[model samples]
Target: MTVDESDAYVLRDELPDPETFAHLREVAGMGPRSLEAIERGLPNTIYGVIAVHEPSGEVIGMGRLVGDGGAVYQISDMAVHPDHQGKGLGTGIMDRLEAHLEAEAPAGAYVNLVADVDDFYERFGYEPVRPGSKGMHRRIE
Candidate 1:
């Protein structure tokens, strides 16, 4: 019920198990994150897309949308396993996330994301917020 048929890979509209989520992020070069954060944050995802390698049933890619549904939303934790690069899985994930946002977010809702590469996100109508606003964040130890 979670995965679609006809392929060695599939996308599921659900959160990956925490272990898979963390593992994919690391293998995808996103760096390791606190397990505590993963546990605390995943449940709050307004939507999550996970790519599974059907042969292994391994979650090899993921992306999440988080924030207040009516006003603020962000596309976060996007990553694909290194072995799965150049296969358009990222695009597939983003397409899913964007569709969900388009359907669920309010007309004026502000959607944002911290993009590692601008060009990839540009294809999705996301542009730099520069000249108006900049992204800032702080780490909590």
Candidate 2:
């Protein structure tokens, strides 16, 4: 992030623990995720970025890269706690994740994210692959 955050947060290149991950996701308005899923899926993250509140050492923001390491990569769980929104933690999280892909991903690696917010990912070089190709999903029973 271009904004200075050194005083309040320490950005870490690691995923948060399962409980913290679930809580952060819910408080950030992404809604609650199953602990079962969090535990199962977090281990698969190829790379993750975390923002820790220095005063409390809480994980306030995060983003992760998940997919087969060679060709497919998706930016998932991009969120910042509502109280911490304006400090650029979201962008900082993305910055670290993007840097990881740049250094580690292959020549033709595909990076994508489901942007729930408008225009946020475009600055990071993402465009919609919609209308012609829809993004589909199904919840496991």
Candidate 3:
């Protein structure tokens, strides 16, 4: 049965528990993350938000911000369970994250995220940094 999101959903200022976090990532096809890293890192989150199915108490979506307490921050681990996509859960997560950034991140701080879907991030005022600059990453062995 399709849940009528207007009333049966909740956005909470909380991180998903490790298992739920991992499961959401998998279901969203975001690939795998180190469980050990997640265990160590989640507690240090600057701010995070989770969407839940109120009746089931299940995490349906989540997003988080992490970085040095002062200047730079990155939005990471944004995902929604496959069954729960297209219902504005991702937007709800971004709304909370944006509020936290507005409230806490200092002026001139750089906020960035790697986007699998540019259209989604673009809606939040993010633009590609191509000709003038670029994004680079190195995975640790």
TM-scores, each model vs. reference: 0.92, 0.91, 0.92
lDDT of 2 by residue, 68-139 (tens): 999999999998889888888888998898899999999999887888899788998999988768888887
Best by lDDT: 3
lDDT winner between 2 and 3, please give it: 3
For candidate 3, write residues 96-121 as lDDT tens digits: 99999999988999998989775898
- For model 2, give the 10-residue run with minimal summed lDDT: 1-10
Compared with the true structure, model 2 gives a TM-score of 0.91
How far does residue 53 in candidate 2 sit from its true spot (Å)?
0.9
RMSD of each: 3.9, 3.0, 2.5
lDDT of 1 by residue, 18-73 (tens): 88888888887776888898998899989999999888787889999999888999
Which residue pairs collide, candidate 2?
none
TM-score, ranked from best to worst: 3, 1, 2
lDDT of 3 at 26: 89
- TM-score of structure candidate 3: 0.92
Better of 1 and 3 by TM-score: 3
Query: Which 10 successive residues of model 3 have the least lDDT summed?
Result: 1-10
Clashing pairs in 1: none
**lDDT (0 to 1) per candidate:** 0.88, 0.88, 0.89
